[model samples]
Target: MKNASFGVLLALQFLTRIPIPIAVPWTPDTRRWAVRVYPLVGLMIGSVLTLIAFAMQNVPAPITALAVLSVWVALTGGLHLDGVMDIADALGSNQPLARRWEIMKDPQIGSFAMLALVFLLAWKAVLLWALLAYQAPLWWLLIVPGLGRWAGVALLVLTPCAQQKGLAWSWQQSLSAQDVALALLPLAFIALLAPAALLMWLTVIVFVVLVRWAMMRLFNGINGDMVGATIEGGELWLLILVWSWWQFATVSPPGI
Candidate 1:
């Protein structure tokens, strides 16, 4: 592709059924740029879900919430959530590191895997309940998931890969300061779009700290699972912060 950056994003959207395509090779450089542009995927995802939620708002609240969740799940093909499930199952089992790796590697779902999916879906449901109830600031959806994916990009760019080669390594190896710099540029421009631009940075900071701690305790180093988990968890953490901020703004008085 002429522009590797958009090509990378095209690849993500291609995976997500966004109707974009890569006529050229999915080169390492292109993949790296995709990581940078990964936020756009989130932006698209959030936008679609928000619009669906907005359209269904006059519909029953629960129905609207289901529509939002349905579209969100459909957009990404449930890839990140799958990551969240594998990682959660691995973590919940309290198995040794090697065994955990084996479990993560296994395609077959386990009890913990089932638990993880249930918990994640439940959390997303509750979160959507709050967001749909109040109908969260649509702009934040644009910023939060975009920034969370950036956190995943930052993590890959910073650390050495646990495995020698894979899609994750393709990213780890291909990414550079220039790519990271370019990625931030669009986000910087987004600050003018909303104050949540700064809150987005807070999401990055929190993910880095929390993921670093979790990786050290759980995985001991980076892996594809880590990438997926970071994207999913960081998104949730950022959303949780947004909810807390909303609660702060409008909660009723104690005397009431």
Candidate 2:
């Protein structure tokens, strides 16, 4: 129980800018538990966004959407966004695998990275606006973040590390199939909250598979930046799915 408590704090500290006053030791056991609780960290983030959404429920959706987007970026301190940029710069370089790694390591933002950030934030902002304006279920805001992080956990567990060092490699080393299964238990509870959410979970699984395949093809294996990109991309894709459902589907999303 103490280890699990520390693991939650470790995940929150690593994944978000939220201040966790407790000191968490860096150890193999805590790291493995941190992996197990990644989704919970995300749910914590989503809960914050949901609160913001409710607080500004009456405000103009464009303004509210931007507010939500800003909070989202601020909360994570753009950690995953950095990953998106790094991956974009690497892939856009069109170099060999080794050269791509070199490009990703470069601190300078290239044209591709700038474009990727713009498009990603733009899509997120617009989707948040649509969801708010159209009155999609607010619980989805909670679910998507957890789903995104779970996608990261899945990628970490299922893919080989691009390098034998670094945090991603360490997490991959520490995680096991049981940890992965434990991480998924939260999602099962979420499914019980909204049976319709199973569709979104299915979508996340497909996204993870495609991302894993692409990472193998492009980077030759997974890395921290790739996992971060997976989280950001997963969140965006889930947002897109919810918007599409609200816009076109005949059935109403549960709770709406």
Candidate 3:
């Protein structure tokens, strides 16, 4: 369990710009829980981000947004973002399936990739800005990443592999229905602890189902790129949801 936690933390520490310390001996299994501990990792990260933003009552909203984004870019090394760019580039290509794969493999950024990246960053910055500007409650901040990431992982667990071999393939093969159930059990505990977050939890559940169905239509199955897209898209929707709800919050926020 410690190994799993360490692995989760390491991946979180790798994927986000949050600073934490937990030195553990790396092992064969450490790098293999993209399907397992990603939500736990997101929970930790989102909690830290919310805390930092909430604690820094003096900071401007734009600054806070940058701080959060800076941390995210640093932590994950743009792990999923890279996939988003690659897939975007491939989709833009009016070529054969094999050609699309080749385009993804190419290091050069195509026009479509550039445009998609711009849109993604623009949405990311805008969404965070709105969240901050609305002075969104800390609870919304704390919960968004957890649900978004868990939704992504759930998709990974449910969808069949779009390909036979890749990092995603290994992660999928390592996971079973039981492993996924075990991972999600904590979500129930969380919901039981805080019923208000049920909306956030349900939002993630809905997004996961929609994303899975859409991916099935698009790729006919899921793959690394599909997973990455799911994560990115889910997060985008989560931010939108939080921002929309922030308007109706009963408690006025510090920044507002």
Ranking by TM-score: 2, 1, 3
For model 2, residues 1-256, the per-residue Cα lDDT tens digits are 8888888889999899988888798888888889898998888889999999999998888999999999999999999998999999988988988999999989999999999999999999999998998877799998899999999999999999878998899877778878878998887888998987789888999999999999998888988999999999999999999988888864554332
What is the alpha-carbon lDDT of model 2 when measured against the actual structure?
0.90
Each prediction's whole-model lDDT (CA): 0.71, 0.90, 0.71
Candidate 3 lDDT score at position 112 = 86
**Which pairs, if any, clash in model 1?**
none
For residues 114-153, could you state the per-residue lDDT of candidate 3 as single tens digits?
7887898788877787677776557666666666667767
Best by TM-score: 2
What is the C-alpha RMSD, rounded to one decimal, of candidate 2? 2.6
Candidate 2: worst 10 consecutive residues by lDDT? 247-256
TM-score of 2: 0.95
Q: Which pairs, if any, clash in model 2?
A: none
Q: List the residue pairs that clash in candidate 3.
A: 14-75, 14-76, 15-75, 15-76, 16-75, 16-76, 17-71
User: Candidate 3 — worst ten consecutive residues by lDDT sum?
Assistant: 26-35
Tell me the spans in candidate 3 whose CA falls farther than 4 Å from its real position. Answer: 1-34, 192-194, 248-256
Stretches > 4 Å off in candidate 1: 13-15, 19-23, 252-256
